[model samples]
Target: MGYDLERFVGYVNEGLLCCVCRDVLEDPLQAPCEHAFCSSCIHGWLVHHNTCPEDRLPLDITHLRPLFRYMRNDLARLQVRCVFRPQGCEVICALESVHRHEQQCDYALLNCSNAGCPVQVSRRSLEAHLCVCEYSSRVCSSGCGYTVLNTEEAQHNCVSELRAELDMLRAELDCKVEEVRHEMESRLDSQRRHMVQKESLLRSEVDELKGQLSRVMSDVRILLGAERARRQELERAELEKAELLELLKKEGLRPATPSEAAPPPAEVQRKLSPRSLALDCIKRKNREVTVI
Candidate 1:
């Protein structure tokens, strides 16, 4: 121990590796007894033992302080490996570029954060697997293949399959509804045709009945007119026959033959009286009714 500032300045560039993590000294700190340690290394050591390995002094994590900004910048300029390279990552970078490189490294090895799918996988392959992975799923509009979120690769909810099933069911229901509508339309058309046919038949029947009713009314009027005329004729014949019979009585002559007994009228030999004419018309109407 002799003071050597120039030598120490040259040696600062040379780094010490951590015994546990094997990374370069991240934030070099000192124990109370003057031994130096990487902050991370010391933190791990303190987790199990509160004393420093070299000095055996009591240690506390609260005593850790922020590294100098300039020192951090200098350390960042040093060479480092791709943090997850051993699993499949091929990229190596300076410590400064490690953050950005790790984010984009396709070959980086990744452990599935899902409690269910705990397989170790490459970052690029992890996304591909999640597309068909069973444990982690995401909502998909087109198909059941679950899409993985780049930002939240391991936190997708497994609902894509269910959503796909629901969509299928809705499609099936729609088909059924369309089928029912078609059937109803067919039935309605059939019923409408039947009603139209029935109405046509009823209209034809009504037409026939109207024609018969018209003929019957006309015949009834003609028969009634003829009966009236015939009755008047019969009345005149009865009056003539009465006058002839009175003449015979005045002359004191007895009518011996049937022709002399009742003088023949122009219409009939048995000329009717007024009351008899009306009775004969009634009897003819009754006989016609019986014939009908």
Candidate 2:
């Protein structure tokens, strides 16, 4: 609601009065119809009826605007008494300054600072009342780390309070420890799973390597067998060569005994020369060796 009309030092223009409350407009707003009302009054009225309170004309919150500059200046210049005048404050000020004055007014009533204190005291006496309020609180002199109310001072037990605080701390510590333990367990389980995967991967790699090794060993064994067969064949060829030499000796075809050998008849010599016969035998042996 707007300020009480009686609080003004002189007559207030009717135009400055709220259409809803009929009081001097406080934080006034004007409708498109040129009628003004206290902002709160207009908003509250609009909640029930969407029409200008003065003309009953169609209106809405969207149609409201700030009061005209001249009207606002006139409203601000009006002399008003302190809101706490009934409480012994005798200050008077412009309408615009009334709120500031009342805020600092020594006679303004305030709720007690203490919790659960129902008493309201004037600003001038608030400090004095707070000093004696039974609900007022202060830290325990016994260093129990707790605020004790004046009313409960006689029953306050410092030892019990401290014990309860210790118990609370212990419970919090236990909770933190349990949390850390669970986190560690979770980490360990994750590591174990990772290790298991790594081990499986490693085993798979090892098996792969073993299979490759087996293949290599099989190839090596085959090569070794082939080499052995080649060596034995070479040995057999050498033995056959020695036997051929012995047979040539037995047939009296040795060139070293040419002086002791008998000469063939001219007819036999013409049919098969000795040099030609030797060359034929060599050619036959070369063919057999090439086949082997």
Best by TM-score: 2
For model 2, the stretches where C-alpha displacement exceeds 4 angstroms are 4-10, 19-22, 29-33, 37-69, 85-92, 115-118, 142-146, 227-292
lDDT agreement of model 2 with the native: 0.85
lDDT of 1: 0.62
- Please report, as a residue range, the 10-residue window in candidate 2 with the lowest summed lDDT: 254-263
lDDT of 2 by residue, 239-280 (tens): 655755554554444333333243444553454435356644
The stretch of ten residues in a row with the least summed lDDT in candidate 1 is: 1-10
- The deviation in Å at residue 292 for candidate 1 is 99
What's the CA error at residue 75 for candidate 2, in Å?
1.3
Q: Each model's TM-score, in the order given?
A: 0.33, 0.64
**Candidate that scores best on lDDT:** 2
What's the TM for model 2?
0.64
Cα lDDT tens digits, model 1, 185-231, are 99999999999999999999999999999999999999999999999
